[model samples]
Target: MKILILGIDGYLGWPLALKMGSKGHEVIGIDNLSTRKFSEEVGSDSAFPLPSPSDRVKEAKKILGINIDFYVKDANDMEFLKETIRKHKPDVIVHFAEQRSAPYSMKDYNHAQYTLDNNLGTTLKLIYAVNEIDPSIHILKMGTMGEYGTPSLDIPESPFVEANINNKKDKIIFPRWGGSIYHWSKIFDTDLLLYFNQIFGLTVTDIMQGPVYGTRTTEITEEGLRTRFDFDETWGTVVNRFCVEAVLGLPLTPYGKGGQTRGFISLEDSMEALRTLIENPPKTGEYRLVHQFAEIYSVNKIAEVVKNAAESLGMSTEIKHVDNPRIEAEEHYYNPEIKILPSLGFKPKKNLKDEVKIILEDLIPYKSRLERYKDSIMPKTKWKK
Candidate 1:
């Protein structure tokens, strides 16, 4: 199968490309390198230095004997994107190219606008490009669990809910409202994909993923093939941030009462989920939604896990309650269904403790770099005025 991965320079994208190439698939990777540039602009560069895309492809060929064609281009440019699509004519398109940080989107007006434009514009262009070339191309877009926010009811894999109005029965996509501008952009992407599927018979799969943690994968061993690892408040997820704090001997910062519960997945599990979806393409004119997560943990629970992991390794860590900066519920109901991938023979291998141990050991060599950016680990962006 020919696979094209956008945002192939991302934390998840880089590893996915390697996995696909190793599986004897023809892989073409594309990225604009915006995430790296954004991290530099915000003083939160990756803890581990990353090789350029060209260097990475060159190294993979020499070491793994896998050839991956890589191109540096912006996906928002309709003309360039269409040309690439037509040239490659991929069987599956994995769309991971977006500004993927809630706090970064809420930093200011400019950041918010950039997130909205870049994320939505790219999806819109992809829809058009696929429609023009071949509607049979399966599009696997990366959606977020944040798009559902804190709804009153349990979240389903597909947001569609059964409804009866005036003795007439119908099923509709659940009402979606996001917590931040970044999440809102994902909601827009979901709706747009549904529209394209309905109108143009496009086959699309939107993986509503949870917060992903860890920095290691089976295919990524050498330093040159490593994915970027960011542990700052802006780009880091809660679990990743907590592990870094434990390693640095700093208090695990929990916002408010720390009752915020969310789903999480190890980096290895995330890659498997993508692979499963790519192999099993949905039927034509199908807009499939699969909630991709391994386990669920609250903010306080994760902090305690990190603390315990550190203590077992002969290191003491602290947990501190910090003032909440985001405009979200301190405590709420969050039950999300994620049985689709498991039913498809995808099993999550690593638990929270296992993931923490892997991440802590991986960062041992970068202790100095972690300490240098420790001051920027606290939340600085607020969602409210």
Candidate 2:
């Protein structure tokens, strides 16, 4: 299969590209390196240095004998995106090019607008480009579970509800609300893909993923092939942040009541789920939704797991509850169905403790870097003024 992956420099994008390439797929990657730039602007760069995208590709060919074609172009650029698709005529298009940080999106008006434009605009362009070039091409878009907020009922993969109005019966996509501007953009993406699929017969798969945390994958064992790992307040996920705090002997900062429960997946499992979906794609004119996560854990439980793991390794750690910066339900019902992946042969090897232990062990060598940027690890971006 000829696979074209956008945002190839991202935490997941880089690893996915290599994994697919290793499997003998003709892989092409595109990115503007904006994630790295965004981290630099917010004083939250990756904990360790990462090689340039081109350098990494070159090294992969040198060491692993896998050839990956890379282009440093923005996916939102309609002209470039269309031309690339027309040129490659890809069998699969994996879209991951967007501003993905909830806190960063809420930083200010400019950041919010940028997030909206970059995320939605890119999807809009992809829809049109695929429609014009080849509607049969499979599009796998990355979405967030945060789009559902904290619904009262267990979240379905593709939710639908029946309604009756004026003695008329109809079924509609389940009503959803986002927790932040970034999540709202993903919601828009979901709707746009559905619209395109219904009208133009576009084949699409939207993976609503949870918080992903891990430092390594099978295909990314070498230094040059490593993916970016952020551990700051703005860009880091909770698991990553907790691991870094433990390494620095700093208290884990659990926001508000520390009862915000959310789903999580290890990096290895995320890649495997993606691979499973790619091998067995949805039929044309179909918009499929797969919930991607391995386990569910509350913020307090996550903190406790990290603390216990660190203590077992002869390290002291603490937990501290701070005011929640985002306007969200700190304690709410969160049971999202995620049986689709496992049914498709997606077996996750690591549990919560194993995942946390892996991250803690990986960060032990980066303690100096964590200490230097310790002050920037506290939550500062508020959703409301």
| TM-score, prediction 2 | 0.98
Reference-based TM-score of each model = 0.98, 0.98
lDDT of each: 0.90, 0.90
Would you give me the overall lDDT of model 1?
0.90
lDDT of 1 at 382: 78
Give the alpha carbon lDDT tens digit for every residue of 181-230 in model 2.
Answer: 99999999999998888899999999999999999888887778889999
As for candidate 1, its clashing pairs are none
Clash totals in order: 0, 0
Q: Which ten residues in a row have the lowest lDDT in candidate 1?
A: 150-159
With candidate 1 superimposed using the best TM-score fit, by how many Å does residue 79's alpha carbon deviate from the native? 1.4
Predicted candidate 1 versus true structure: per-residue lDDT over 54-86, tens digit per residue: 899998898888999888988888898888888
